[model samples]
Target: WDEEPFELIVSNPPYSVKWVGDGDATLINDPRFAPAGVLAPKSKADMAFIMHSLSWLAANGTAAIVCFPGIMYRGGAEQKIRKYLVDNNYVDAVIQLSGGLFFGTSIATCIMVLKKGKSDNKVMFIDASKECIKVTNNNKLTPENIDRIVDVFAKREEVAHFSHLADYAEIAENDFNLSVSTYVEPEDTREKIDIKKLNAEIAEIVAREQVLRSEIDKIIAEIEG
Candidate 1:
């Protein structure tokens, strides 16, 4: 970071990597993290990297960074940082990706899109967790899947069970939890079952079983006689 602002910033930093976050008392005074009024925990440097990218972002710039899901709803210092981001309208969107998309791990990850200048106070949440095709051991997003995500994000449209546009008030009510699942309702795909029909089928099977048992016993008795 040479103090020069960039129009776009993108990164996929290491997950939950430890850093000299709060451990260094003066680190909070740094302009990048100072706005949040608190530093990312030393154990989890996720937000710290975000702050760094945000600091170097231009006025109309947008930074899209992949992040661990925990930072979305984690409490304490992380919550405080999230509160700051939401209150300032720095967060543009949060996209949830499917699990098993990477090697060595099957944990679901999220993308936190940050913008210095936002057109609106609402934050868009896109749940793209189901937009992947299983490829060998990892899940891969096809071109169509990527296009759908990009289109929804660009349009900022709220699709039922897929995306949501949450206002600042709603975010405040939820304590600044930016988790996509919190905003976008996942579709319930489980098949519906009729209890009455199932019970009748079980009863019919039991009746057939009883009749077969009776017939078999009668045949054994006849043979013996």
Candidate 2:
């Protein structure tokens, strides 16, 4: 039996698996990894699957993969593979999902979208870490949340605090780090303070303290008398 090329591929490959050592050096010579010119470390096989999916990806197809967050920015062989992918303009978009979205673990994960034929020389990054509703035991992506993400992904627009489209040169300037957080800025939800209001409150508190001190002095004087 033979497998046919697919137009769309989606997978949640094993998080991190040791694929090298113990006489597994032959992986370095595999055709899928040979293009990268560097094999994913024996202790980490994330790139191996990535390369394999890419090898199987049709010229016009896209592969959406769920990947461990570490592979995006980790240095060494993984970094080398990332450099190759980014340099070749195969990466499409990277989306950062918030932690606690998956069951049995709360560690954040990311999605890597790869394409063989790209329309542009840039990569779209979506910071959807907060696009989930808290359920009983885990965070689940609501339909609205999913829609919001899909809309942004499809449009490839830079939505403030949500997404950013980074050019190849920008990626190279950053050393080919594919982490979504590296490109998409998260929303700052911290409350903004009004300096004038804060100072007025401080002054009111000081006045109350002075009045209390005056009352205490009056009590002391009466006792002395």
Estimated TM-score for each candidate: 0.85, 0.89
lDDT of 1 by residue, 42-102 (tens): 8999999999999999999999999999999999999999999888889999999999987
Clashing pairs in 2: 20-42, 98-129
lDDT values of the candidates?
Answer: 0.94, 0.89
Candidate 2 lDDT by residue in tens digits, 9-95:
999998898775224667668888889988888788899899999988889999999999999999998899999998898999999
Q: Which stretches of candidate 2 lie over 4 Å from their true place?
A: 1-3, 21-25, 100-105
lDDT, candidate 1, at 102: 77
Q: Give the count of colliding residue pairs in each prediction.
A: 0, 2
In angstroms, the error of model 2 at 48 is 0.4
Model 2 misses residue 71 by how many Å?
A: 0.6
* Ten contiguous residues with the weakest lDDT in model 2: 19-28
